[model samples]
Target: MLKDFSAQSLFMGLLTAFVGFASSFAVVLQGLRGVGATELEAASGVMALSVAMGVCAILLSLWTRQPVSIAWSTPGAALLVTAGMPQGGFAYAVGAFAVCAVLIVIAGLFKPLGRAVAAIPAPLANAMLAGVILGLCFAPFTAIASDPLLGLPIFVAWAIVAAFKRLYAVPAALAAFVLVMVLGVDLSGDPAGGVISALAPPVAFVLPQFSLAATISIALPLFVVTMASQNIPGIAVLKVNGYEPKPGPLFAVTGGFSFLSAFFGGHAVNLAAITAAMCAGADAHPDPARRYWAAVVAGAGYIVFGLLAGAVTAFVSLAPPILIEAVAGLALIGAFSGSAVAAFKAPETREAAAVTFLITASGISIGGISGAFWGLVAGAAMLMLLRLARKEA
Candidate 1:
């Protein structure tokens, strides 16, 4: 294993870790907070997710001898924002997280279940995802509306860098956010005295409490989003890069990690799509066999980042919450755009996709069920009706 190490691979692995952590962390933080987490709890959740996914990535990469990158399910976190405060507060939400994680594990073990998840119409699935993230995606603009001096610079930084390299745009926005935090925000009323003192990793053990409402509203939708948006796409990315690890074991392993992390305030973990590409690509190493080292390095990097999450959370919390959400929104823009395009691509399913998108984005609730769940139902029904009508005609 030591013989496989290379300087290029080392650099690429660390880069993968940096990009993965910096790009979408705000979304995770906000997602946790949205479901009624205290600041300390949210920070703890971030650390738990980071550490869990990091360990999972390292173990999988070493076992398979492939660049098997693991990641938190960012889309599931976005779904949390829409789900709002779960009934019975964060404990029930934690229970929902556990339930979703179990479902993921079962999906891996049961071929029929996995196939059923995979069988969802791509257009409707994509639309549901797009709708879920649509509100967050507007944060950059709305943040600017609230405070142009702080927000414009961040947007400008992201746009300028994105013009050159689309991959680095969100990080650039994050850097700009740091700059804005320094210049614009005032953090004098010290609670922990300063950010440095808050450097230790957060630790909060939440007792899980299941509820029928959370099961219907949070668990099922979260399971679907994690599968459709993150896990499947991650596997596809790996295969495209010439690695073909069995999907079942990987899914089950990640779900197990996700389940464990849930007790510590985390949401869910999955295989990485973006970071996987980074680790598996030619940039990691010219030799395909050597690229797994990048994932190992990335895993190690995530652990280190996890250790510092408390400080990052404490520091960022000083700024207006909207600013953090704005950054999160920026992080998800690519996903939103991709889903939107895919949703409307097929003329036959366009109406069904529209129904899903509209319903999900509406944030409606009925009988303790969320709009995301209802959107899927309504869209499937619309598609069925259309099919029947065509047949009759």
Candidate 2:
């Protein structure tokens, strides 16, 4: 097992995991809060997701002997922010999350269901996701207006790094945000070193409360985004890297972990796309066979990070809420760009996609359902109408 271990792979693996976590964890925290999680619940949720992904990645890599990276559903987290909480609040959201997890597991176990999920029009999915994140993407500008000193530097750092190393921009901004938070603000009254506690906070359980509105608005859309935005691309990444493990089993494992995590306030965990390439590519190890070590090492690193989730969450709570939101927004700029490009890539669906983006960004809610669900419904309806008109033409 240790034969393929090398310093280079270890470094790369650790780097990939850290970058993945640091870059978007704020979004996860925000998403949890949006769904009405208390500070402790949000912290526990992040910790649960980190541990779930870490454990899943390690077990999958060992079992498959492949560089299988796992990540939280970043897009799904964005969805939560937009969806807000149901009248039933966090418990209802947890129920929806559980439903999504079950759907994913069913998709993995059933070939047709998996194909059906794959068949969701790519443009529509991208458009819906694009719309969901549009508001948060504007946070940096808003932050600057609200608090120039704390926010401007974070935005500047993100912009500068994005201009050079796009992948690391958010992490760079996070570092700057933390620095500003320390130097500019006063943490003197806060707990000195209690951030790193004797143990991570215990996971809080929420009993599932099912509702049609929550299921339709949150569960279904969450499943679609998780599958379309994360899992599909993750499979493609592994395939591009010349490893073709059966995707069905992968979905099953991630879904199972996601299901377990829901009770503890975590969102979906799935195969990773962006970070997968880092571990699966030749850069991890010249010999592809040895590259699995990169994923293994990354998994170990994530576990270590997960152990500090309470500390991270506590620190986040200490920051100005807008500052945290601004940082989260900056973290997702890449996803926003990617989704926008994908949403508009097809000329035929461009109008429909645009409609979706606009409606979702408008944040309209009907019958307690969020704009995201309506955006998908509206866009899909428009696409069909356009197709029918073309047929008649």
Candidate 3:
């Protein structure tokens, strides 16, 4: 495989890593903050997750000889932002993360549990994911309406790149967004100079403090979303592209890394849905066997990016909050589109999926549980009702 390395595979790998990391890191940061982390802790969370996922991706791809991409759970992070800080604060959230990791590992190790998780209705899961990202997907247009100068150019760049390269659309838009942020905006006026320092250190260990509230609210919901929304679809992406690995083992590896990362303030790590396609598809390499190298290279790229976590954190901090959100929103456009398509694809499940999407997007919380869990509940309820009605009729 090493001898067969080609420029196409290398470029594909680089593109995969760039798109995976650049697009959603902002949401990760926002999640840490929402869970009551300080700037340093949040940066640590980013670095830890990046390293954990990078290492897992490399190991898994090498073992399976497939483009088994790993990633920090972006949907889980979005859930965190919606869930807000648990009553037990960041420590409690960390505990919940650890719990999620354990549950994932259990699901991976126990065949029945893993099968049960995999059994979640695809339409409902996709609807839930669509609901999770809906708010962020609105960022670009919202930002443009609010700040035309800063946002319009980013949108233009996205549209132009999408029209041409297609695959590079979001990344190209991101590059343009960063450029505009640098040139069009004045950073000197801020109290802290917006210079990004490359001297990012390692993650700081945090003691986990578990609470029933957090366990139910954050842990269970996070695990469900990670498995149903991220992992299942991630596996499907590889299967659709003709690269099937044993899902249980892959889940175990990612879950083990997630468990380890929790001590260092990172959330769950799991199979990547979006970037997995980049590595698995024909675009990665003409020879399917050699495509694993693309994932290996992407893993290495993620480690390098993780090392510069401090710089990225500092740089994002310097930008306006809205702009940061806009970039994150732009990054999720493809995901949003995919989930929307999947959610409404089935005529039978359309109404149930709609219920899930509306409830999740509504962001309503009950008894400390997040809307994501409730969205699933609502969707499941509707699906069951529909089935019962159909049987009676």
Candidate 4:
């Protein structure tokens, strides 16, 4: 295992972390803010999540000798976007994060719980995910209307890069955003302070406050999204690449880390799907046995990026909010497309899936509960009714 460390693994690991963090972090920030986190708190969440996932990835890959990658749940964050701020504000959101983490842990330790999560109708789950992200997916186009000069270049950069290499597209947009901030957006005070702050790392911990509303509105939906979209797919990706680690322990490990980070405002962290492919695939290393090194390196990279979360947050703040949203939206388009296709792919479940998508996308909240939770509830009801009718016929 020690001999498996190679230059290729190192390079691939660095690239994977860069892509993973750069791609969806803006969405994470947006979601955290949506749930009523202050900018400082949001930065803290990013930092905590990055470090936790990094440590989880490193520990898992090293322990199992597999290229196991971990990441914050982008779709789970999107679900938070639909969860309007609860009465307890960020603290309540943090409590929900803790609850979601505990659920994930339970799902790992208890097979039945895990199976229940897995039993969610694929179409409905995908549809709910699609609905959650629908608004963010519109950011790029809306950004064009709001700030054409800054937004157009970011979108154009992403499009052009995606044409050549899809993996690098979001990072390219992020780079363009940074460029716009430096060259285009005017700033006050010593911008150097922000840069310097990145060197010291950040700490903005909050005491959690639990409530029924946040548990129903945020925790349950977050757990479902993280499990259905990220954790399950991540395991499948590993199996596809011929790595057969037990899923239960992996989920448990990720859940433990997520739990630890929740106090600091992080949402769920789980197995990575896209970046997992990179770490587990031939690109990480031609020799499959030693490829775990790639994940280790990626984990280290994540920690390094984590230290700069405050700086990244500050940098993003310099731009108009619309522009930040554009970057996040660009990051999620792929996820949205994939979910939408999966939702409508099967003829039997298409109607139910459609119902889920529409309601979720509508952004309606009742009794302080997000439409995402309602979307799932409604879709399941429709499916049950439709099945009963067919049986009668």
lDDT of candidate 4 at residue 41, scale 0 to 100 = 84
Clashing pairs for model 2 are none
Best by lDDT: 4
- lDDT (Cα, tens digit) per residue for candidate 2, span 1-393: 788887657856876676567667878988988988887677678888988889999999989989999999988898889897888788999999999999999878887745644444778767766676677678889989998999999999989987986655666776888799889877754431333333555567778889999999899989988876678667755665667678788898999999999989998999986677668766577788888888888888777777788665455446666776677576556557767887899899999989887987897866444566577678889999999999999
Full-model lDDT for every candidate: 0.80, 0.78, 0.79, 0.81
Clashes of each: 0, 0, 0, 0
Q: Could you report the Cα RMSD, in angstroms, for every candidate shown?
A: 6.4, 6.7, 5.0, 6.4
Ranked by lDDT, top first: 4, 1, 3, 2
Tens-digit lDDT track for model 4 on 296-381? 99999999888887765555455676776677677667667767888899988889999988998997866444677678789989
- Write the residue-wise lDDT of candidate 3 on 1-393 in tens digits: 578676766766776676677667888878887888776777788888998888998999988889998888987898888888989679999999999999898888888755654555778877877787688788889989988898888889888987887666666676877798788787654322432345756467888999999998899989988886678767756664566567788888888999998888899899986677667766677788888988898898888778888765555555666665676566566767777897899999999999988998897866444576678778989999999999999
Task: Say which candidate scores most in TM-score.
Answer: 3
After TM-score superposition, the amount by which residue 121's alpha carbon in candidate 1 deviates from its true location, in angstroms, is 16
TM-score, predicted candidate 2 vs. hidden true structure = 0.64
- lDDT per residue (tens digit) for residues 1-393 in model 1: 998999777766776676577667778887888888887788788899999989999999999999999888887888888888887799999999999999999888877655654455777777777776687788899999999999899899889987897756766787888899888998666623322336677788999999999998889988987876678766655665566667788899999999999998899999886677667766567789999999999999899888888665455457776776677676667657766887899999999999998998997866444566678779989999999999999
lDDT of 4 at 351: 92
- lDDT score of residue 198 within candidate 3: 55
